[model samples]
Target: MVNVYVLVTSVSPLTSFLHDISVVMTIQHPRGQPVKLRDFLLQHLDPAASHQALRQVKQVISKVLQAAAASTNKKLRTISRCVLCFQLLTFTLLFSSSVTPVVVQVDTQLNVSGLSNDAFDQQITKDLILEDTLHFLLPPLSHLSSHTHLSSEREGSQYGGCTGTLGISLSEDEFLLLLHFQLLMKTSSAFQPLYPSVSSSSSLPRSLSDLPDLLTQIEGFYKLKTNRSCRTDEPPRQQPALSSSQDEGLCVDPHLRQIYTDPPLILTPPFHPLVKEYRTEVTFDTMTVRIRPEPVSSACRIHLDEHRGPRMANYPVGLGNSKISILVMDGSHPEPVIMSIYTVHVYRESRPSLPMFGYHVMCSFVQDCSLLVQPGRPCGLQPHSGSQSQRNACSSGHVSGRWVVPCLSCSDNRTCDWREVSWQPDGCYHPIVDHPLLQDCMKDRKLLFIGDSTNRGMMYFLMERVNSTLEDWGKAHDTLVYRNLNRGRTLVSYSYYPQFWLEKKQRPTFRQALQQLLNRSQPLVNSNQTVLVVGGVQWLNTNHLRTVSEVLDSESLSNILVVVKSLGMGFHLPVDGIRSLSLTEIQDLYRENDDIVTTAKHHGYEVIDTFSITMGRYKEFLQGRCACHFHEVTQLYLSANEALPVVRAAGLTADVLLCFLRWRSFGPQNLPVTERPPQTRTEQRELYIHSAANQPCQTRSRTRGLNPQPIVLEDQ
Candidate 1:
């Protein structure tokens, strides 16, 4: 009952042609299921399938090759080459084998459209015919009972003892099958277009051009659902408190649900996670009011209006709450003018609320009548801190012609006057000003005052103050030559160069003066030995001023008072003076002054604001005169004496003396008692030098020449 059948199916006409080629080969097999030729040959012939299978395989291979020619992947091409080589080898082995005989027949016509050469097709056709002839004459053999027989025979042969049974070798078939299977696998791996679910009606596209319409519709639906859920799940917001006034009532009605839903309201979250609350109580002359929710937050804005001519507004009461306190005073009397207070709280998105808290009280007297309350002045806003027990002593009472009543404590309390109360809190106080460098200078160095008569006045005032404290200190002296007066240690020196112009009068330039001074005293003025204070020219009209810039251009004025003033002083003449002058003159004066200040700064000089200091102190005395006369000088000296304490406090310590000549008396009684100046020239000059003289100036060699020093006598 040896029966065999080969069934083949084809999707294209190419597969049918390949099947026709396979029918030309003849094979015999005992098969319940189809018998493979490889198994039959292993039992009879030494090799696997007969060569006739190669012809049919070639036909099948042609179709696969045609498919592979269309493929872009290099791996697919490699697979086709490997499959063709295996088929050729199988045919050679089958033709050499003397095992099972087989018939060859064509299964289908080959489709080689994708193949590049016709020579390959002709070679396959010749090979297939030759393999069929050998397969038909091969002898049949029985299956061996012992596995050793098959192993020994296979060891002597090159076919590796693999059986070509069941009409075809399973391994060989598997190789061919895998090749085609791989093509199927690759084809399956490609991306394919997806179709929308039929159940969705909204998936329809709006227009052929609107490719994303479906996605947009889905997203819109999702957003709508999310927003609705958010709205429904949110907690109701608590409303702020309102006054009992009918006008301030809420406008929402019971039947207004549709109105509420028509347009949803959006609210911003609080800036910080934690909620802050505060309370503030305000007291006017005759009224006291407390605002709700203190520390006004951005969520609430408060507006205040006063009936009086002057406008008033509510200020934040605390650090983080949305509350503001308002107090209105009665402005009817000349006593303390009070104003009417109206308070409104505006929510970020809602109408303003009425006054949450308020009250009226009558007061005996009003306080803080001015628009701008002066610092350190008494006002009712000050808290009573004299004693905890005395806080309740004051009582409120009604006064005639006053409608509102004041708090009992605020009305009768004398401490309620804000001007009398100090603004310093219970434990807080102003810091004392201290700089290490200033302290060191005051304690260790001798400062030189080296300007004009004004500088002399500053020196005198400083010296007087110092001498008053340290009785052993000597008085200041003025002379044309520099003199060191101390006998042993340098106590202090006061020298004067009294030329109306420190530089040559004809040249009138800072460069010339700096050069002359440096040439004469560069060693003394250098950083190590001295600190100089020099400024003068308040007396020079616009016509005679020599700016520091002109001087620096001519000579180096490094480390000098002239350089300091030129750099640091920001002084300009009155606007009226500049306007009155011609443009050319104005430009020249401006440029010269600017250059002087700049040069002074370049030299690292500390430009003391002498002009401002002098102007401010003796503004009245110098009101009408370009130069200070004897009387004015005397007044200046007196004024400097009075200002000595302030100067010391300012930390100016210098040794150089200042001198001013005037006809007024050095005695206190010389000037009118009522109109007496604040300081005299001698006193001011002495104070200035003493303040600067931390150490006394040592006496140096006196000049032994015809020009003798003028003797300076102390006032008895």
Candidate 2:
């Protein structure tokens, strides 16, 4: 087989599908080994060599080839996935037979890292009219053994659910995305018929089609299984499965905080086709789990047995205990999950269970009298320590004398003396002037926050400090990013609940989200310099938090700086609000958070101790003002007897963040001691809520209600 080196150079992008990219190629092959294009390309497509242009080109080519072959090579099967990311990056149709094998031995070095969005996309259409050209890019559908089905049409409408979208223009960008998405999912299986069939006779299908119903069917199956109490193999009591159309889609609101717990139990000893696995088979007994919330608490029974395994140790779950899940940490893993169990095991019912990698956790209920603490594998503890580094607020030259700043708003100017406060010099300092060093450090970087509103606040807070001039603040929808195009190309952005589930389709799995994030970021950003924060502001319940953390505990988690903050801000419970968690419930929530933090840290994530800071400030900022959205913080009053802007809140936090950015870097360094509590502890005592006993445990609730909705949290 001959090997060829081709350089792709740019053409009119809006005109053509890809700009040609150049790379000096050196193809090294064991002599006489069959050199398929897929093998040849995989062996040579180096990011270092091609400025990452070869990435998309490689995916399209590889998927087309890999799907064509029925071989389930473990390497290939394990090649997980991401959202359908199709950018007209670079490259075009591939025909292995088309390549005239010739090798030109040459060595040259050029960096293409700056070349953004240069790669091959089979279905990325620039013009709606040019959809036909995209068809040429993909291998013909004849390559795949099966074709994907499009959802049936609604009366007089091309599109269906999220019904308003029907008759939407095909030329719209969303339509293109919807189309590409359909193609990606259809193709997602293995590499066969990645795309639906289209005719040479017509340019566009006479009728519009959306994602195949099969995708929703899978989601429906999982939804029906979430939170089910115990079941061993033999599909949980025959529930009616819905067709794709009837299934509730994955596109729940980004702000929608939901937790689905499906403790799926599988039997090791194979069961006969007709044999029924019963609750009694494993020496299991049932009992109720009583949570404080009157209605969120269900009469769900737990199944426990005393059988011990080589790795798993049984713990007796005391009745009516606050804890909701069993976190089984196998000692063999360095910082990885042995397995986990949640409410699903006790529910014996199902509803869209939280999306998790079922394969990662082997869950079965075992009865023990008390929780067992495994050595070196404590169930609920942050494993890491804080950095010794500290930058004092008193040290900064920007602060020379006593500065009085405005705090939260005051009504009727009551209690004048109580309103005036002195700036505390004990913590980190935010320098209003002379941050050139800090600017240079963060320059040319893309900082993104993807959780709920607190993360949105985080993005807003960071933007206030780094860039002097803000471009497009709060204007963009779906993704909110601060653009500093001229300086460092430093883009700071926030995505409110970053679209886990598309509008009507099923929510994407974690791997898919990771892929989309990676695709968006500049290729060079990795664990050393960036942090991917999850779980700070949404889905505080055990099931949801576990789901989010489980997703965070991914292969991508290792390569990137992963920071898992507990859900909700501890301080935000409205002092007199109609809805609020009792002190006990809050403590319980924090305890749940600690368990998640331990699991996350063991799986390689830096846990931020927000719970400590929020608890301490609960009497201050949280009760200080009943603000729901940390939309923008303003110092309402300068000081007693002085009318001015409230700069204290921002001033204090700015300094704290300043210390974080300067000394407590996200890459490899632990948080600075000043930012981290002296010690990290996970306890339910409200008095020590602010104790930093655990450097990595922080749970600041950010859910909408001051507490959970009093409404019965039964299966919808």
Candidate 3:
């Protein structure tokens, strides 16, 4: 008998020979049974070989067996171990050759380290530093294919060997093979489908029937088997399957269709067929997902599985949470036909909290069709941290101030009071003194005043004061040169020539024409020729009064400096009838004029508050129709009296004689006589006739002539 037992331990000299014998045994025993060493040898030998040769081997085996039978139990145990080792080797070879190939690649540095025997030791440390240096120079993911190897082992095997196991031991090459295999798998796994490389020989079927039966089967799978069971806490019944037509319209996995239909859940396996293979499959309890199609044609429609029921329907297209549908028509065809259907998954939005008062919010779509909320009109909100809490007062609809009183019937005592008066001395009316310009003005200058009739009043008053102080010293002129330059109104010009000379003691020559009087007149007078008088007073009474500042500041008077007084002061009173106003009404009118003066002063222009001045001297003058009848005499007298304190406080000397003459000629004057006789019948009758006729009587003709008397006044 050919002895099958052979001592073939890893340390034995015959180990290599025994391995070769094992390979031969695997080849001989196709049924995976253990083969005897003699049978393995016989398969390789020719049939013609002598039986003596076989007998010789049998004799040798018999001798060895006899010795093994006689040997100690320890020796026998060694023989059994060798036999088991040989058997194990045979089984390993058979199993290894039958296995599927497993290839793994080490692509990244991290993966390369895994292939190393002791990854955390010297090899990885060196590799890591090398990777860092080369990282910048490395190509991107799309490029580069590294060296790779193929290694294969049986599905279940303890030992495997290469074809040649001479110089290289199996253990020595195992790690290297695994590393090379890892690289092969990695590179192959990264292979992407070359879509452009594919020929377009396959076209879409002309009709639904022409499509492969597999397509209908896939549609059926989506429609019938896609839905999954809801939680046990919910209803037990299954959701209805979508119709075949509906299934054909959507491209989705049968198992995932139900999950996608319910509450926009993030799919563990994403909807894309190619990506689905790479993702981990899991059931998430809660997730937010947006589903939309690529190359979204107009035939796109969005349907909600919950609200619109199981049946799919066209959704109204608009911007909102509502379902949307877009219809695509083929313009090339005489009649448009539906080629394909698409479903867009609209993104759901969470409701935002209401904005606080004074806060505004705006919602708009971004360029990428995403909803965006932005802060809009800000009320009390500032750019600081505290602005978030602030609310706009105007938006809150609350009033904080006192109520304004409208025009109302006045109480008997309160009729004259538009506003409460201050018993304290009025600060608005005060003596003017210590002006820097006054000293220069006092050095004998010609001042001309030119404007409307109201300006004539101001001119007369200024002339009176200067002339009265410097009777022989200054020459004052109020030449009645009224010319109508614009429309029907007259422009009055007043010029003054003083006698004192700063450089020479002689009087300067005077110019006659209004223009020459203004521009060429030499200073017989002070070098200062500027006039401090009012003009455009009548402009205040007209509608143009509102724009008085604009007119006075116009280019025509750009070279001159003017001091205006009570431009809007005079009020028109009704001459006739039942609408006659009382003293209180007249006072209210005066208050309105004061408001105008206050406005002018607020704008930084110099405005003389003539309200107090005129109110003091002419109480009855405020009552009615006094402005039209006011001649130069009354105007000059009032102005002189009013302006006296101003001029004195300003410390300017007055020409008293000239002042008297100017005042005397201002109006037909019974003129401020201290004593008067009781009226006779004829005198009383004349007054009655004059009053009734409302006309100036010839009896006042004597007063019209210019008075030449030099009057002296006592200081009171």
Best candidate, lDDT: 2
Candidate 1 lDDT tens digits, 71-160: 534445344333322111111112324223332222222222222243333333333333332222221222223563555344334222
Error of 1 at 496 (Å): 4.5
Between candidates 2 and 3, the lDDT winner? 2
Q: Provide the RMSD of all predictions against the true structure, rounded to 1 decimal.
A: 40.9, 29.7, 40.4
Listed per model in order, the count of residue pairs whose N, CA or C atoms clash below 3 Å is 125, 45, 24
TM-score of each: 0.22, 0.31, 0.21
Sequence-dependent TM-score of model 2: 0.31
In model 3, the runs with Cα more than 4 Å from the true position are 1-454, 469-529, 535-560, 567-588, 620-716
The model with the greatest TM-score is 2
TM-score of 1: 0.22
- lDDT for each residue of candidate 2 in 1-716, tens digit (9 for 90 to 100): 22211211111001112111222223342222212223344455553433232333434433433343334333455554222223332222323332322222222212222222322111111221123223323535653334323321231144332445544333233333344433433321111121221211134344334332322332233423431433332111211111111112221111101121112223323322122221211111222221110100111111212113221112221111112232222323344332322221221121112222121111111111122211222221111222213533232212212222121222211211221222222233322222465576576555655665455555554554455433334422245544553375566555445353366366554445444554465454545466555554435434544554455445344465555555444323332222445555655665666776667666655554444334322322211112222233332222456331111121223333444445434321333343332322232111122212111112111221222211110000
lDDT assessment of candidate 2:
0.32
**How many clashes in candidate 1?**
125
